[model samples]
Target: MVAYDGTDFSGFQVQPDQVTIQGEIEAALHRLTGETIQISGSGRTDAGVHARGQVFHFDTKSGIPLDKWRFVLNNQLPDSIVIRSVEEVSSEFHARFDVKVKEYRYCIDNGAVPDVFRHRYADHIRSPLDVEAMRQAARHLVGRHDFTSFCSAKTVVEDKVRTVYDVRVESEGQVIWVICRGNGFLYNMVRIIVGTLVEVGQGKRHPDELRTILLGRNRELAGKTAPAKGLTMWEVSYEE
Candidate 1:
């Protein structure tokens, strides 16, 4: 397992010459084992997104003890990335394909006062938001349906259908948390959903309009995509 701040990395994928979570982890692994191996992650988190329980898997031939792997690899990795644990799994195990569910959380700072501590983790909006309205709007998104409207225009996915099992909004003090659990999600899907809900919270649209917008099946019908900094890969479940 791995947890990363993801602020400085380009994204989770290993791109050509760009700093990324995968790139850094692979580099660390190569340095530790002297063998270059490719690692596959559970999800491809966008740049500036954080993850608390991201999982990855790779086939390795090294005989190094599993307990020593974390120690040696983490010493080579930067402070932003942390290897939470290392385990030897069967060859059939695949991190991405074996995932049964994914839960994502997006945090919002709703108060007028700026929180310096949370600037990197939560999206700050000075304007007050109606939490109840946002909650009501989220009800329309739960269940299996086409999510083309919530996906990014940059994405080329032909099959836009996805299952959203639950979407709940809650508030504590000045921070509002939007938690979503789904079987799978398209690129930028959760961020877009949160943006659409924010529009309802701002009184720009009625909560009931979300149903019509969803049926529209057009990206233009959805609100703007929320910034990546506020989103986090909260958890992932796999069938044992």
Candidate 2:
């Protein structure tokens, strides 16, 4: 497991000439093991996004002890990325394919003035959000459905179906939280859902209109995609 601040780099994937989370980790592994290791990540987070418990796996034949991996990697990795834990698992266990559920959290600072410390972490929205209305609007999203309306227009995935187990919106003074748990999500699905819920909280859309949006299955009917910095992959689960 790993936790990272994704403010820098071009997301988690490796691109030629682009600094990425994967590229850095692979480089560090090479420096330690004298072998180029290809790691498979649980999911690819977008640019400026964050992850608290993101997962990745790689097959290594090096003599390095498993217990020393976390310490060695952290010493070599940048401050933005930290390997939280390192353990050996069966080769059949895949990071992305074996995921049983994933949880994401989107944070919003609804204060009159944005906090300088949270600038890289949370989205600062000056407007007050109607929490009750947003909660009602999110209820329609808690189930298996086609989420095409909430997906990005640039998404190339043909099957837009996904099962969302839970959606909760809550606020603590100036901080608003949106938590989503699901079997899986499409590209930019969580951000679009947050944007739509924010629109409902701002009274720009009726709470009941969420049903229509889901049935419509058209991207144009949805709200703007919330900024990537506000999002975090909170946790991921696998079945025993």
Candidate 3:
């Protein structure tokens, strides 16, 4: 697994001409292991979608050993991506299949202007937001439910029902954080949820409106999708 700020790269997946985090990682792995390994990630993130605990796996023919995997890989990887740790597990321990939960966080700069440095990591909203309203709206999103309204219309997944264990909103000075943990998420699900919650915070929508939208199951009835730069894959869990 690794964590990275994808602002400087094209995306997580490997592309033919464009430079990507996955491409760099595969290149490094090939160079070190002398095998053409196929890397499999938990999911493909769009360009500029940052991750704090992205998981990936690849089969290696070389017997370089497990303890040195992190040191060997990190030595060749760019500073933008950091390999946190590595451990040998059963062959059945899949990165995507054996996962328990995933968490994401979206940051908002609720202020007059955005900071130049923090602009890439947080969305800047000029209007004053009602934090309490946002929190109340988020409560409706918790628990197992069909979240078709919160996902992107282009999502091709057949199943839309997902278990959202928690959704929380909090403000610390100028920063507003929207955090969500779920068993699985559809494409752009977190961004849309944040957008709707932001509408509730701005008093443009009522807290109860979230329930209506969920029941409607219409993407058109939901709020606009928020920007990707503010969103981060915060964590992933697995059963020990």
Candidate 4:
């Protein structure tokens, strides 16, 4: 498992002339084992997004013990990233393909005063949001559906069908958290969902309008994509 504050790096995937989570880990692996390695992550988070339970898998023939691998690898990586745990899994396990569920949490600072300390972690919204209305809007997004309207129009994937198992909104003091769990998600899907719900909370749209938007199947019908900093890949689950 791994956790990272991704504000400074690009996305998780490696790109030329860009710092990324995968690139840093691969570099550390090369320096520690003297062999070039590639690691596959459960998801490729967007820039400025954070992850608390990101998981990856890599093939290695190094002699280092599994228990020692965590400490040794952390010593070589930057403080922004941390190796939370190291374990040995079966050879048949594949990190990306074998994922069963993913959970994402988006934080909104709805207080009148923005939190400077959490500026890097949460998005600030000064306007009062109707949390119940947001919850109502979120309920419409639950279950399996074609989410073309909620994903980025630039996404090239032809199939937009995905199963959202749950979506709930709650408030804790000044922070409002939107939690979503699904079997899979399209590019910017969760962000767009939060945006649409925010519009509903602001009384700009009715809760029932989400169903119409989903049926419209047009990206333009959806609200703006929420900022990436407020989003976090909270957890990933796999079969036993």
Per-residue accuracy of model 1 over 5-72 as CA lDDT, tens digit each: 98899999999989999999998888877898999999999999999999999988888898898888
In candidate 1, position 133 carries an lDDT of 95
Please count the clashing residue pairs in each candidate, in the order shown: 0, 0, 0, 0
List, residue by residue over 72-158, the lDDT tens digit for candidate 2. 999999999999999899989999999999999999999999888889989999988899999999999999999999999889999
Error of 2 at 47 (Å): 0.5
Residue pair clashes in candidate 2: none
Name model 2 segments beyond 4 Å from true.
none
Q: What is candidate 4's local distance difference test score?
A: 0.94
Each candidate structure's TM-score, on Cα atoms with residue i matched to residue i, is: 0.97, 0.98, 0.95, 0.98
List lDDT for all candidates, in order: 0.93, 0.94, 0.89, 0.94
When summed lDDT is taken over every stretch of 10 residues in candidate 3, the lowest stretch is 38-47
lDDT per residue for candidate 4 within 1-240, as digits (tens), equals 999998998988999999999999999999999998999999999999999999999999999999999999999999999999988999999888999999999999998999888799898999999999998888889999999999999999999999999999999999999999999899999999999999999999999899999999999999989999999999999962
Model 4 stretches astray by more than 4 angstroms: none
Model 1, stretches more than 4 Å misplaced?
Answer: none
TM-score computed on alpha carbons, candidate 3 = 0.95
